[model samples]
Target chain A: MSQDTLFDKVWDLHKVSSLPGGSDQIFIGLHLIHEVTSPQAFGALKDKNLKVKFPERTVATVDHIVPTDNQSRPFKDNLAEQMIETLEKNCLEHKIRFFNIGSGNQGIVHVVAPELGLTQPGMSIACGDSHTSTHGAFGSIAFGIGTSQVRDVLATQTIAMNKLKVRQIWCDNKLSNGVYAKDLVLHIISKLGVKAGVGFAYEFSGPAIDELSMEERMTICNMSIEGGARCGYINPDEKTFSYIKNKLCAPKNEHWDKALTWWKSLKSNENSIYDDVIKLDASKVEPTVTWGITPGQSISINQQIPLLDDLAPNDKLVAKEAYEYMSFKPGQLIKDTPIDVCFIGSCTNGRISDLRVAAKVLKDKKVSKNVKAFVVPGSEKVATEAKQEGIDQIFKDSGFQWREPGCSMCLAMNSDKLIGNQVSASSSNRNFKGRQGSPSGRTLLMSPAMVAAAAINGKVSDVREFIN
Target chain B: MRSKFTPPIGKISNINGQCISLIGNDIDTDRIIPARFLKCVNFDSLGEYVFEDDRKTLKGKHPFDLEENKNSSILVVNSNFGCGSSREHAPQALIRWGIKAILGESFADIFYSNCIAIGIPCFTLPKNSIEEIQKYCHNQFLFLEIDLKKSLAKSKYLNFNLEIKESSRKMFLSGEWDATATLLANTSLVEKKFKELPYIQFCNDN
Candidate 1:
C-alpha cells in the first residue's frame, strides 16, 4: 500500500464505507457524461424507475457523436441526432447542467470539466469515458467507467469500488524542448506494456512532472488508462492551485483561501510507501510514436521497429500481429513510414497548448500534397482561444482544416473517418484497429507537433527537425 | 422510441451451460461488441449485436453463429479478456446475448468490475485449468457446472477450482452485486460527507 500518496489520500477521503467484500463505497464528487455512453445510462435509470440521487454533482456534454464539420441542428446522422437530443432531454428532465454544441463551455467532457474548474484536487471523479483520468492532473482520483457504472453514479452519487494498489511513476529530469507530454506518456506506455497497470492506480511524480503545465500534466494523465491503470493522478502544487483558481465552477470569494489550503495539503507526504515505483528519465525520452494497434507498441522517432526475434516469447504473438496489421517492415526506420491522414485533436492533445505547438510546427509550412491534415480543438473554449491566438489561421494556411471541437476522428463516431487502408498520424489516444473509422485503417499515435511534422513531410518524421 | 424489455438482474450462485470458447489472448472489448454497436438507442437490445462484426465477418465459422453454440450461456476466454475501452456495453451485450458467466485465465480490471455490476461474474481459473476447459469446449455439448459459492467448475473432461476474489464472490452470494442499491442505502452519510468538503460547501453557499 502506498501510504500517503495523492491517490491513497484522495481514495481514503472519498471512501464512504467499506463493504464486507474488500470494496469501498466510494463517493464520486463529479460525474461527467457524454452522448455516446450516457443515453444508455439514462435509459437504465428509466428502466429501474430511479432519479439521479445527486443531480448537482453530475455534468453532461456531447462530444463523441457530435459532427466537427457541421454545426447545423438535427445532425445528419440520425443516430447522432437522436443521441444528442436524448442527452438534452435527459439533462433538462434531471436538471443537470449540459454544455451543448454551441455552448462556449461545450467541448470534450474531460476538457470541459477542467477548463470550467469543476475538476479539483482530492475529488473522486467518474465518467463514462475512459479518458476521465484526464482530470487526474489536478490531483483527483479519476477513472473511466462503463454505462452501468454511470447509472450507479447517477442514482447514488457513489460507486462500489475496490481500492487499488498504488504505483509511483517517477519522471526524472526535464524533457528537451521538442519533446511533449504526449511523447512522454507514449514512452512510459511502451516500457510498461498496456496491461501492466491492470490492478494499480499510477501516481506520477518527481521533478519532470512537477515542471509541466496543467495541460501538459493533463496530457500525461489522459493516457494513464492506456497503460490499463484504473486511474492516474499527479499531486496538487502551486501550478495546480493557480490553474484551478477563479474559474467558472472553481471556488470563489471567501472560500478561495480555505479551498486553496485544503488542496495544498492534498499532496503526498515526504516519506510515502508505495506498492511499486517505476522511474523514467524524461530527458532521454524522445517524441515517441506508436507503431502498432496497441498503445504500448511504440518507439522513438530515431528508433526502428523491433524484429520478431528481439521480442519476448509472450510478446511476439502481438508483435507479429502488429507487424502484419501495420504492414511495416520489421526493422524499418519508424521515421520512414508514410501516412495518409494527420489528425491533431482528442482529449489527449486537443487543448490550446497542443494546438499552439502543432500550429508552431505548421506555421509557414504547407502540408504535403499527399497528406490530409486537420486540427480539432479539444473544446469550444480552446477553439475560441486558438482563434484569438490566430493558431487556426496558421493551420489553414498550412493546408490543414481548422475544424470545430468534438472528439472528431478520435473514435470515428461521426462523419470524419478514415477511408479504406489510409494510415493516419493522430495526436489522439488509442491506435486500436478501426479506432479511427475504417476497419482497415491504421493509426500512429504521437504528439500534436509530431503529427504536424508527419503532415508536412507525408511521413513519420522527427518533430525535433521541424522545431526551431 | 421503442420501449424494449430487459430481463431483471440475475441472482444465481451456480450456472450450468455449454461453453463458447474465444481462445485468444488480449481479446479486447471492441472485438466483443465493436465500437459501432455502442451507439445504441438503448442498452436493452444490444445483445443481438454482441460480437456483431465478428459474427458478420466470420459468419458461419464464428462460434456465436455456430448452430451448436447458440444459446450458450458460459463464455471461456484466454488472458487479458476485455482489455480495451471501458464500455459497459461489452458486458451488457454479453449478458444480453445469453452469457450468464465468464471463465478465463485473466480479466481486465474494468471489464471484470463491469461484469459484476451487471450480474455477470468474471471468474478466473488457473491457467492450465482454463486451458483444460478451453480444450474441453471442443467436445460436442460440453456443458459446465460452475458453482460460485464453492468457486469450482466441473465438466465431463475437467474439474477445477476458480479464483474468484472473495469480495466479488461475496457480492454475488450476498446479493450485493448491484452497487446502486447499496450506495443508495447510505444516502444520509454521503450527504454528510459532501457537506464537509469546503469547496463543495462554498459552491452551495453561492
Candidate 2:
C-alpha cells in the first residue's frame, strides 16, 4: 500500500468509514453530472425513492450529446433533446447548480469546472464521465463512476470504493520545443501499457510535470483513463494556485491565502513511499501519435508501425486486430498517411492554449481541399477567449471551421461524425474502432498542433516540421 | 434477446450457466455498447444494440448471435476486458443479453467496479487457464457452476479456482454490491467528514 503520497493524504481525509465489505465509504466533496450519464442515475434515485443527500455539492452541465454547429434550444435529434431536458429537469428538482448552454459557463464538464474554479486541491471528486480524472490535475483525488455508483453518491454523498495504490511516474528532463503535453501523455501510455494502471493511481511527477502549464497538466491527466488508470494527478504547485486564483468560484481574498497555504502543504512528503516507481526522460519524447485502436498503440511521428513478429506474445492478438482494422501494413511509416478529416477538440485538447498553438501553426496556411477540418473549443469560454485573441479568424482564414464548443466528434454523440470509412487526424483521446461515429471510421490521435499540421498537408505530418 | 431481461438480486452465492467465450484483449466499453446508443433516459432498450457494430460486421457470426450461445449467462474472455469508458451501460447491456457472471484474465478498474455495482460478478483466472477454457468452448459448450464462497468454477470436464477481489466477493455474497444502502448506513459519518474536510470549510462556494 502507498503511504504519505498526495493520493493517500486526500483519500484519508475524505474517508467517512470502513464498510462491512472492506471498501471505504468516502464522502464526495464534489460530484459532477452531465447529460449522457446522469439521466439514468436520476431515474434510479426516483426508483428507489431517495433524495439527493448533498445537492449543493453536485454540479450539472450539458455535453457529450450537444451539437457543435448549433446552440439553439431543441436539438435536431429528439433523443438528445430529451436527454438534455431530462438533465435540466433533474437538476431543477435536485436544486443543483447547472451551467446550461448559453450560460457562458457551459462546455465540456471537465473544462468548465476548472475554469470556473470549482476543481480544487485536497478534494475528492466523482463524476459519471471517465474523463473526470482530468480534474485530478489540481491534486484532487478524482475518479469516474458508473451509474449505480452515481446513484450511491447522489443518495448518500458517499461511495464504497477500494483505495487505489499510487505509482510515481518520474520524468527526469524537460520536453524539447514543439513537444506538447499531449505527446508526453501519449508517450507515457504507450510505455506503461494500458492495463499496467488497473489497480494504481498514477502520480505524474518530476521536472517535466512541474514545467507544464495548468492546461497542459489537465491534458495529461485527462487521458489517464485511456492508459487504464481510473485516476491520475499532479501535485499542487505555484502554477496550480495561480491558475485557480481569480476564477468564478475561487475563494475570496482572505480565503484565497488560506486555500493557498493548505494547497502548498498538500504535496507528498520528501521521503514519501509509492507503491511503485518508474522513471523516463521527457526530453527524448517526440510528438507521438496513436496508430492502433487503443491509446497504448502509439509511436513517434517519424516511426513506422510495429510488425507482428516484434510484438510481445500477449500483445500480438490486439496488434493483429489493430493492423486489420486500421488497414496499415507492418513497418509502414505513420507519416504521410492520407486523412479525410481533421478535428481539434474534446476535453483532451480543446482548451484556449490548445487553440492558440494550432492557430499559430495555421496563421497563413490553408487546409487541404480534400480534408474537412473543424475546431470545437472545449467550452464556450475557450471559444470566447480564442475569438478575442483572433484565433478563430486565423483558423477561418486557413479554411478550418471554427464552431461552438462541446465534445464534438470525440465520441460522436452529436451530429458531427465521420462518414463511411473516412480517416481523421484527431486531437481527441480515444482511437477505438468506431469511436468517432461510423462503424468503420478510423481516428489518428495527435496533439492539436499535429492535427493542424495534418489539416494543412491532408496527411499525418510531424508538427515539429511546421514549428521549424 | 434472451427472454425478458431480469436483473440479479440479493445473496448471489452461486451462478450456474452456460459460458460464452469472447476471444480478445482490451475489449472496451465503446465496443461493448457503442456511444450512439447512449442517448436515452434508461438502459431498458440497450440489450438489442449490445455490440451493434461488431455484430453487424460479423453478420450473425458473433457469439451473442450464435444459436448455441443464445442462452449463455456467463461471459469468458481474455485479458483487460472492459478497458475504456466508465459507462455502466456496457454491463447493463451484457446482463440484459443474459450475462450473469464474467470470467476473464483481467479487468479494467472502473469497469470491474461497474459490473459489481450492477450485480454482475467478475472473476479472474490465470492466462493459461482462461485460454484453455476459451479453446474448450470453441469446439463444444461449457457450463460452469460458480460458487462465490469458495471462489471456484467447476464443469463436468474441468475444475479450477477462480480469483475475485475479497471485498467484491463479500459484497456479492452479502448483497451489499447494491452499495447505496450500505453507503447510506454511514450518514452521520458522512456528515461529520463533510464538516471536517478543510476544503469544505475554506473553499466557501458549493
Candidate 3:
C-alpha cells in the first residue's frame, strides 16, 4: 500500500460516517462562531428547542458589528445593538462562551482563537466565516461553514462534509531580505491563478515554510480563501508545537507530549502522493499588490496593467470591467494610482508582526495630509504587545489612528467606512468594489508596509523608498 | 415538529430551453452580489443587484437585467461558483432574484450550504455535463425537472442528485422553516438538559 498523505490520514481518523449522498460526516474538534452569522442558527435551535450538544467545543466573539471606536452599551446603530443582544441571549441560552467588546479576549474571530490558544494542532476547526482557514496554520483542517451548518454543529458535534483532495505546494529557496510570507503567498496565488486551488486543500511545505514563524504562517494561510482554496495549511513542526505549548487550550505536561506526537503524525508521509503539486521559488517573490478587482489581478509594484488588446478574450472582458469599475486608464502604471485612506488591520495582515513592520516604516514620519491612515491590531493580545513595544505610540505619532482591536474597517460592518469614492491603500485581503463600505469606494490591496508608504505619500508609491 | 418538513413554498420550475452561459472561475460572493446591498434586512429586491458591475454594461440585454427574467430564477454559472466571502446575503440575494435553482460545475463550500438551506436546488453537474447543458440551452428551452419527492432533478441534457442534509432537504421540500424541524430532532435531549440546569443557579453563580 502507498504511504498515506496527511490529508488521507487525517480524513481516515476523523471520519464519523458516510452519508447516503457519498459525503463523509467528519467530526469537528472545535467550532468558532461570531455575532453576524450565528443568530439565525441559534434561532433555528430555539425553534427546535435544541441545546448546544457541546457548548465547551464552541467559542464565540463579536467582531463584525462592534464599532472600532466608542463601543458603549446601546450602540448608535440599532442593528448592531440587536445583533450583539441576540448573540448574547443565544450564547447565554445555549451556555456557549462569548467574548464581547472590551473583553480582553475580544478581537477578530480568527485572531482571538489562535492568540488565546483555543486553536490547536491536529484539530479540525470550523467557523461561520471564510477566513477560518487562518487556523490551518497550526496544521489543522479548518473550514468556513454556513449558518445551517452552524445549527448542525450546535445540534451535533459532527458536520456532514465531503472529503477534499490535498494539493501539496512545495516552496524551496530562502526568502531574500525584505521578502515576507505575505509576498510568498501572493506570488504563489498569482502563479497558480485564483481558481487553481478549487476542490483541494493546500498543504504548504518547503524549507521556507519551515523557517516561517507561526504568526507568518498564519498570515499565509489567512488568505487561502482568496486563492479559491477552502483551506491552506502547513504541517505542524517544532515551531507549531512551541507556539501552542503555552496556549490556554493546549494540553498540559504529559498530555502535551502526547498531543505533540499526534500533531507530528499529521504531516504527510515523505512519499505521499498529492492530487497536484506546485513548486515556488521564495527568492523570486516580491511584495505584491492588486491593481484590479480580483485577488489574482495583481502584479509587482513596478508592473503595469496589461493592455486590453493583449489579454485573452475572457480575461479581456474582466480587464475591461475592472478598468471601468476602477475608473482607471487602460495602460496606467499601478504605481501612480492615488489613494485616500490607509488601513493596516484585518485577519489578513493585522497582527503584532504586521504592526511592528508598519511602525518601522512610519517611525519619525508623518502620513501625508491628503491621506488618512490608521492601524487596528487583530487581537487584544496583539494590541498589548504592540503597546508594550511602543508601536502604538509610533503609529499615533505618525498621524495614524491607533484604534482598539476588532475587525475595524476590513469589511466596514461598523462605523469605519470610506466616505465616498476615495481609494484606499489597504492591507486587508479583498479589493472588491465597495468592499470597504461606500458603494463607490475603491480599495487597493497591499502589504502593511506598502500601505504605510502610501499613507506617507498619498499615492501608490513604493515602500522600498522608506525601507531604510 | 414533524420528522420531514417541506422545502420553501415558492412556485418551482425548471430552466426554460433558452439561456445564456457565463463561464468564469472563482466567481466570488462580492461579484455575485456586492456588499453594499447587504445593508437591507429583507432580500426581496436584491435580484437586480446580482453581478451589478457585469450587468451595468448589458443594462437592457442581460437576461438578469430583463424585466421578464426578473422572476425567471434559474441561474446558469460556471465551476467553483460563489467562492470567497461567506456572506449569507449572497444566496439570499440570489433567492430573491427569483432563482429557483442553480446549475453549475461546483459551488463554494458556504454558498452551497446556504443554497440548500433556503430551498434553492443547487444542481451540480459534471463540468462536461454543464457544457452539454450550455449547448442545449443555446437553441431550445432547457427544461429541467425538479422533483423533491425523489430528491432528484433532471433536464433533457442533464440529471443530478442534490446532496443536502437529510433534515434540511425535508425542510426545503416541505416549505417549512428549520426552527421546528431542528427542535424535533433532539427534543428529548434538549428537555433533559434544560431540566438538569437549575433556573436559579445563573443569578447565584456570578
Best by TM-score: 2
TM-score of chain A of each: 0.99, 0.99, 0.97
Stretches of candidate 3 exceeding 4 Å from the true structure: A1-3, A309-314, B1-26, B36-65, B124-206
lDDT of 2 at B100: 95
Q: How accurate is chain B of model 1, given as a TM-score from 0 to 1?
A: 0.90
lDDT string for model 3 (A76-125, tens) is: 98878887888898888888888877778889999999987777766678
Instruction: Tell me what fraction of the real C-alpha contacts between chains A and B each candidate also makes.
Output: 0.50, 0.80, 0.24
Residue A102 displacement (Å), model 1? 1.3
Per-prediction TM-score:
0.97, 0.99, 0.86
A251-270 in candidate 2: lDDT tens per residue? 87888888888998889988
**CA deviation > 4 Å runs, candidate 2:** none
Write down the C-alpha DockQ for each prediction. Answer: 0.57, 0.80, 0.22
lDDT of 1 by residue, A278-384 (tens): 99899999889999878989999988899998887667777877787789879888886899999999999999999999899998999999999988899999999
CAPRI-style class, candidate 3: incorrect
Question: How well docked is model 2, in DockQ terms?
Answer: 0.80
| Model 3, span B1-206: residue lDDT tens | 11222335543333332343556655778777765565443354666577775576466676566544443445777767887888777886666655667778777767876776666767666677677766765555566666655656576656766443454455455554333343334445443433332211111111
lDDT scores for all predictions? Answer: 0.86, 0.93, 0.75
